[model samples]
Target: MRRATTGLDLALAGLMTVAACAEVVISGGGGTALGFGVAATLLIAFRRRIPLVTACGVTVCLIAESVFVEPPDRAVPMFVLILASFSVAAHANRRDAAFGLSFLSLAMITTGALDAGDDVASLLPGWALFVGIPGGVGVAFRKRTGDVAVMEARAAAAEVAALEAVEAERRRLARELHDVVSHAVTLISVQAEAGQAVIDSDVEGARRALAAIGAASQDAVAELHAMLALLHEPSDESTGSTSTGLADLPSLVAGVRAAGLRVELVTRGVSALPPAADHCAFRVVQEGLTNALRHERNAQVRLVIDHADADSAIRVESRGTRHQSSYGGSGRGIAGLRERVAAVGGSLEVLDHDGTYCLQAVLPR
Candidate 1:
């Protein structure tokens, strides 16, 4: 882009130099006038790079032509001065542009006074018409270009922010769906297996397992619908609702019990927590119970929700004599839980010792 601009500048300088020389010859001006015209016109090539210097050089040439040669026609010199004033105003900073404009206008006024023997007061308005108008137009053009550039930069930043927000929403939705579906599906699978095993021997046990499966499936569908509704109209409070949180622990515990895992839930000062921390606590417990059910169905799980300290803590410990390999899950659930906890400015830890597994999370308010 810069190279193209330079090429255009050089081309414009060459053309203007030819025009100035032609004008001087047609006006029957001498070689001195022709020389001054070409020099003033050629200085325009450096206007964008060193606008103040170019304007000063052009002003000197114009004044010298009026003083020394006193050309029959001063049209070419006046045109070159106008072009220099505009370039200086457009390309230079405010202070330098102001100085250049004042200097060029004063030089033109002095030249007019010297040529016509007119009063400096009478020449002021004419010089201003030649220099001031072009400078003002150039300043307006510069301001407009700067405003457009600022708006474009802001629009680009907004687009990037919007994209980042969308990606974050996608990640959040994936985590929520994974937790809801994984927990419910695992329950349904276990209940289905239990029902199949006892279908011939115990009719009542089989019936209960089938009932649990139906309940788990229904809950899963309701949660999915809620998430979908959020997608349709996120700003509509009636449609957008959250998934399970700490307050729903009773139902969660009951569901796990129905799935054949023994869960003992203890609460201490968990009356009020921020929504993020509350939801994170629920996911920790849910993932922990789901892991216990999948690996050690008969294990006794002790779940604790404590918010007595400055920070909230959740702990789920499963007591059983299962092999370490049994608890080695695909790691998705734990990773999701960790991400959830971390997002809420919290930490998650999982421990396995002596055939026992523990999931612990600490969240800030």
Candidate 2:
């Protein structure tokens, strides 16, 4: 693109040179006209790169023509002065523009005064109109161009920021979906396994296991529907909150226990928590239970939660499993829980003691 623009500039310079020479040839200009025309045209090539210098060169040529070339032809060739003034105003900085305008004005005034004889006062208006108009128009164009450039830059920045925000939201939603689906699926898999084993041996135990499976499946389907509906119109109030919190832990434990994992819930200093903190706590518990059910079947699980004014916390620990379950995971549960902890301004600590796994999370009230 830059090469194409440079080529066009060079072509314009060549055309200007050709036009200057042609003017001299067709209008019978002798040595002085030919020299000034060729010099001004050649200098015009650098107008964009060194606008003030090109403007000064063109002004010098125009003044020299007025002094030396008799019976001057103010034709297309002389328009090089206007073009130089426009370039200087449009491309050069304020200091260079001021200097170029000052120099051009002084030169034109002096030349017109010298040629006007006693009618010098009459030449001022014509000189001002010719010299000021092009410069003013160029300055206006430069301002508009600068404003447009600034607006374009701001628009580009806003677009990038918006895209980044959307990506962050998608990641959050992905983490949420993982937590929901993993917990429910893990519970269902564990219960179904238990139901299969007990169906042949104990009919009552098998019935309870199947019931837990149905409940887990219903919860999974409901949560999925809510999640999908929220995705469609995100602002829908009914689908926003799950209304699941610390109070739901008993049922959660019961569901997991039906899967054949011995579980206990111990709470200390229970108090009301903010919705965000409450939700984070619930997810932490859910993810921990899901992990235990998958990797540590037939092992004892303990959930300890402390809800207070200053420091609220939840801890889950699972002893090594005696029996391995059929269901497993890719291990994104803990990482997703970590993101949840961070969102609620909390800290997470994991403990590895021999084969046992313990997860502890502390959140601000």
Candidate 3:
């Protein structure tokens, strides 16, 4: 049950009991006491669905009034019924309270006219005011309250969902920045250390290594600038026409081979590659090869791009010796790749079997 509804019912029960008891004591408290007490008990016990029960209680009140002597207080029980109708209408909802009220109004009007004793027409206006107006208004207020509750709940849910989305994106950005910055810094540090260690014994080698360090640092700066621009100002002007794709795969393979490993690049799908598809595909292959080099160095690598069917899908696969312990990943790379693919209605898989780690992707057009 809604909290508002429960609170309303409890409050009505308390108020009715106290008011009914006070009136009973004031009005001699003699005849039809049992009927009034019973009606009060029923209304309090069934406070939420009061009008339905009160319809029956009010009918009994009219009957008890005819059969008994002292009319201790007819007004008190009628007032309690009025209060109960309003309480139910305000808390529960309009549709239910409307139905409850219809019956209560009919019972009240019929009872009033019946007790008129040949002046039934004069009693009509009083019946309408006492029963018709309050019940109708009670139902309207209940419906308005229900609509307000629904709107509040939707607003709360939307806010929660939005916050969760922002948090997830922040975590993704943190991971991306950490991986790129750390790997570049590590390479620069390793090269500087090698140059320092060899400066005295091998002057020529130290100078050559320092030159390589300079090149790596420049490459790092360029990459940092590219990524930062993509993040901070991702407009058409700032990004330019530069892209990493299958068109650039040969150069990428050559770069990895130069880094001291044999890399085989094979392609079967050149004519069917969309630029966006190719770009996303290129990142997957680049990240895969980089992971293999950094974690499983000294292992042979095979890179293959197959444009299977040339229309429905494209697949890229890279394999190398498996790494049990990689410095950068905690197994979230493949999951992130899968999430990216799923965004574009694609699929990704990474399997380490028979001493080889194979990364595969299938992207749709």
Candidate 4:
């Protein structure tokens, strides 16, 4: 569009320059009028690049043509005046635009007054209208162009930010899935190995192991469903069904216990929290216990939530195991928990004192 407009400008300036040359040749003017006409025409080529300078140059030409040209009845070089005035408003800054318009309008009025053999009032209005209309139109075009450019820039910026936010959320969900699925699969793998090892010799032990595998599989599926439900637009039924919170911790503990780990849950002065806080608290406990399951076999784990303290806090501690397990992890569990807690305006702390590993989260009410 801009290139097309520039092409149009060049065409207009060329046509106007030819008209200016015709004015000079037809009038059979002296060198002064011809020189002024030529100079004004040449200056139009630079109007887009240096509009103020070109407008001023054309205004000076108009004045010179008025003073020096003979057969003053001919309104010569008026096209250049109008074009320069329009260019000034379209391209120049406020002060330059104002000054250019004023100078060109006054020059037109002055030339009209000097050339008139009749009432100056009749001619003044027509010339003023001629000068003012182009200037006004140019100013309006400039303002509209600027406003549109601003809106477009803001829209582009908003789109980029939205894309960046979606990317960040995908990364967050990836971390979450890694932690949840990894924990469940680890327990299932352990149970499967045990069940296979004692399949014939110990039938009851094999039965219990199979049950644990089933339970782990169910837990993994439930968690995955909850996450998937969260990803879509929530309907009333789905919203109520898949949400997990502090109330679900008992079942979580029961599942962990069934997998042959001892977990103690203790709470004091901890009333029901908001869903986000409750969910974060649940995750902290879940991740802590998962870590214990992987690294500290037969370790005693204590999960504590205390709201009576100045800062409402949940703590998960595991006394180091006498025998470490072969199971390992990518170590994203604690980091994911920390990010989750931080998202809800909470803080997480992990402490290793002597042989005990403690993970604590303090959340604002």
Residue-by-residue lDDT tens digits, candidate 2, 55-104 = 78877877787777742445654477677777889888999998987777
Relative to the true structure, candidate 2 reaches a TM of: 0.83
* TM-score, one value per model: 0.87, 0.83, 0.74, 0.82
Q: Is candidate 1 or candidate 3 better by lDDT?
A: 1
Judging by lDDT against the true structure, name the best candidate.
1
Q: Which residue pairs in candidate 4 collide?
A: none
Top candidate when judged by TM-score against the true structure = 1
| Candidate 3: residue 234 Cα off by (Å) | 8.6
Lowest lDDT 10-residue stretch of candidate 4: 233-242
Sort all candidates by TM-score, best to worst.
1, 2, 4, 3
lDDT string, candidate 3, 1-365, tens digits: 35223666666666666666666667667536745654654465454554555545554554455345332235666665565556556644556566656655655655554563536665557555666666667767867877899999999999999998777666555545544454445444545666788899999878866776666567657767766676666443113213445676675565555454477776665445555556557657766766665566466777777777633233333345455433455556556666555655677777777767677777765
Better of 3 and 4 by lDDT: 4
lDDT of 3: 0.59
Task: Tell how far residue 301 is off in model 1, in angstroms.
Answer: 2.5
Identify the runs in model 3 with alpha carbons over 4 angstroms from their true place. 1-15, 49-51, 54-74, 88-98, 122-124, 182-216, 223-251, 271-279, 309-331
Candidate 4 accuracy as lDDT: 0.77
The models' CA-based lDDT, in order, is: 0.82, 0.77, 0.59, 0.77
Model 1: what TM-score?
Answer: 0.87
Shift in Å, residue 204, candidate 1: 2.3
Residue 279 in model 3: lDDT:
59
Tens-digit per-residue lDDT, 1-365, candidate 1: 36323777778888999988888788787888888889888888888888898889988887787788772246666777888889889988999999899889877776877766566576767777779889998899789889999999999999999998888677778888888988888888888888999999999999999999999999899989988878877542112434567888888899989988988888888456677677778888989998888877478999988887588889999986564433245558888788788877899999998878999999887
